[model samples]
Target: MSTPNDNPVPTVRVLPETLHRAAAEVFGGAYLIGPVTDQMWERSLPMYRASLVQGIVEDDGVVGGVARSWEVELDVPGGRVPAAAVSSVGVRADRRRRGYLRALMQAQLQTTRDNGALVAVLRATEASIYSRFGYGVASTYATLKVTRRRAVLRPGAAAERRLKMITPEAAVRELPAVYERIRTARPGTVSRPSWWWAGMVDRHLHKDRPVWVLCTVDDDDQVDGFLLYTVNNRDGWDDPQQAVVEVLDLRAVDERVELALWQAAFGIDLSEHLLAHGRPLDPVLDLALVDPRAAVTTDVEDETWLRLLDVPAALSARSYGAGEPVVIGVDDQLMPDNSGRYRVSTDGVQRTDAEAELHCEVGELAAVYLGGTSFTQLAAAGRVRGSSEVLARADALFGTPRLPWSGTYY
Candidate 1:
């Protein structure tokens, strides 16, 4: 067994010019890293200013690893929220299997905790990692490949809305309200922080990018929905003449607005297909595409992995679907205080007890927190055990009705 201090203590430092050079070498040089252009840095200045890039250098002054955060949008229960997204996490190839990554994660998570960040999120390149560090998958997004011939949207009670074409300039003001409405209707969404609307768009979309926005207005002339998207002519070589609309984000206040936005997307000239990155599980996209099948295709996994820093606080935050009593045994390596048997009751109450009904390691417990994974699945995989009845009960209680998803990447 090794300890945090057993290995040579790597020096952690802030971003200095020399460190940037090291970062390039660690990520791009050896890692075949995609270079971060100056423009990209200029755009990320908002998050960068608020963020701290930490690194560990070997005694010889070679950078072994680096970690940093990117500005992210939160999908609160009712609105689009903002969060400090974690990204650019990597270690030098030569340093594979070393503890550098772990050290960087600990230091970074400590910083996040100190900042009182609501949550830290990311899109994992390797799914196997991060769980050990307490991050859980909060949401999953997908790029659906639909056959336009099969799409369907029978307008719900919400009246058909009139569509309007608005530029990104107008979007800055109108899209926020639409996002607010859309997020409110969806579950597992986080609210965007104040700074996001006031600032941050400049970081994702600048004056040079060809990104465009279309707003959907209602009968009252109020902006009810909007879509930020671009075209893929280069990738459409086979269908150069066909219309392909790639959606960045589409949000509406009401079903009508949502339907209208769909219509608006289909209105794009030469667009035969629609490609969206964050379409919720049951979206109204089918209503407009020529082939509804062309609309719903790919299922994507997003959101950062979650770990229970404080089990009680984490467990009690969300409501359990099943109104049953459950005994959970948890084993924690990082914080032994979190290791124990906990009584989680219906109606979202929990307490630690001397004895528990079922026991498992902390990592397995963490997997099911936030409804990212399921206990039944864990048991099926031989990770946790109980009678079949108990397994089903735990699954019902811990499982999210719809899949649990967090859209923002930290």
Candidate 2:
């Protein structure tokens, strides 16, 4: 395609998988097929086939920039929100000065809105890059490491727990129920699709690496919890036997089931240390192990980036933590009215009246929505403009003592 400037806003058309691979390579080596193997292709193929909106800014038939969006169902404060995950964002080094990324984001966000999505998300390669595009940090995940010698198992009058070594096929049949039961009670958790569950069992557990699963059941023979993990033998290292609990998908409602699940993991004598990724802060692991202090907690960085497509509806979906009335002005570059002032009550009811106290842009609101970054922090960074008192009042309105965390990636 040719244009007046000769740069021709380049025909942004979707390419085949082969061309997509070539484009991914030209864009960068990190996004190659290594992380995405053929086995896992089924999991994401729908994103490419049904959900993907990919394009390239071509310069005389040569690729200059690339952008793609993965439509996803996200768990928000209100409920399951239709959303899109804008990922694999890349621009040719030569195309940096041009507005490629901005153009791509605008097109994708608009497309997502048109498709009835309420939000958009991504794990930003650089934190500062996405905010200007109206994306905000909405959630975080963590990886915690604890030494087997130090994990303090809180001894309480729980029940006698048993660990059963299960096959990947067995795990596939057993785990979803436990996970489904757990997410229903949890506020920030999202429902895992059947594809995700299938991937976990078939590819992860039954692969060449030979991952194992431990099922935890109480004396009544009820399956309440399970741990999907791998054990590594690190010879000559400070901690030799390392058990990395990649996904401790436990759903124990009672102390017995909880303790039994931990016992199942703790009973694995092959590893001297235990580490977990995507675990909630208040993990049942806190009750397992010898001296819990040995567990190293590094804030794992992953967030659900949010852009409010519908301001009033999104604002009214979830109730606030407290009952203080504050006026919030949302700066929405995409949706103008979302920028106006509205009174947010502690009970979760919102109104556009004369009494609105805290106000900021939609991006700032997105950053603070997950509770990882506070309104005060954004104000300090000059991302949100306002007085100290206004920022404080806003913080009081949105800040929660326990930060919101997400365990899944869209």
Candidate 3:
């Protein structure tokens, strides 16, 4: 009978510059996204080639499993820190059950930490695959639906909003600056790179459907916010009567500006329905409507899976809510440097030698890292090991004024 020690470790290697497309090819098939064409690879090279790429190589010198990440600045509670925006993670169909996935994840994480990134984040295609790798659901989003005809703003709901319509090319030129100004409003926001902007506009420009960018300008003629969307017929091209307006992206300097943009969406001439995909679970949109029931939330799920590479550095970067200090212990199997006791309070976080009043694995700790979940909630599911008093203190210390939202989808 074979035992766990019978098998040998799979070889994982960093792909040379010429073999980067092999990583993309494996990922394309593993995800079943689309064909790995030269055009697509060229579009993607700007994002990851300058960084690093790793994979498991087969006997023929082709990649069987691949993982790669891009660099970005992550907005924490009080400030922004460097983060690895991971993507293109996949393994070939024949490579399943041989520890390729585990090897790729471990190597990538070690490389991220060694390269000085404190945190890493990714949007998972499968929920169960990442937790064992110390990745947790740090943010969640929902698809918000609104019947356009039924969405009527309350009196004085939308202020004197000044807006302008622009072509896709103009939006590509202007909206990144707008996003930069408003991204600080949320804790989990990330900066979009030039590649992100270029890809976005190119896709919209080449499509048959029309895309519009509506911007709200302030009294001084400064661009305060914008919404990018396209109108589509849900039933079919023949049934143009059922027009659905899909908002791909929206950002605002404040709630008033955001509310005005929603109002404009409702005002689009001939749309029957409006859908805002991957939005934070905020009631502001519902409240602005006269009935508050006009907007319904659907498909609420994980938005970003966050993993800490340098736990102490990640913890010290974010600000916490008001609470007394509490000692929390984390046992990280993958990254031993992250295994320690951390004392946290409104003042700051510090490494402590005191006895831990609460205990959890590194993944479990990350689940509450952005205040997206609470210790009391996790304790109910037996994920948190702590008394009621200590659990409450920990929750208070990690809480944020608003839920963390990573608006950018990689």
* RMSD to true structure for each model, in Å: 4.4, 4.5, 2.2
lDDT of 2: 0.63
Candidate 3 Cα errors over 4 Å, as ranges: 1-7, 204-207, 234-241
Q: In what order do the candidates fall by TM-score, top score first?
A: 3, 1, 2
Cα lDDT, model 3, residue 52: 72
TM values, all candidates: 0.79, 0.78, 0.94
Alpha-carbon error at 18 in model 1, in Å? Answer: 9.7
Give the Å error, residue 258, model 3: 0.6
- Candidate 3 local lDDT, 1-410, one digit each (tens): 22244545667788887778888888889988677787788877876666578888878886889888777888887888888889889899987777788888989998888887889999999898899999988989999988877888888877567998888888777788878876654778999987788777677656666788899988988888899998776454454357788898888888878889998888886767788989998747877889777899999999989998999899999988887889999999999989999999888888999999999999888889888899999999999899999999999889888888987887
| lDDT tens readout by residue for model 2, 1-410 | 43334544544565667566445544453344344446455555544454354557364656666666655555554456666666667777656645666666767777777777667777676677887877777767677776655554667634576667788777777677767765533334555655556655555444554667776665777666667776554342444554344444555665466666665555555567666776666555554545656666777665666677666766666556554566776778776766787776666645576744556788878777645677788878888776778777667666665556666644
C-alpha lDDT values of all predictions: 0.62, 0.63, 0.85
The whole-model C-alpha lDDT of candidate 3 against the native structure comes to 0.85
- Cα misplacement distance, residue 85 of candidate 3 (Å): 0.7
Over 4 Å off, model 2: 1-47, 57-73, 91-97, 157-162, 172-174, 184-187, 199-207, 218-222, 233-260, 281-290, 299-302, 349-356, 385-393
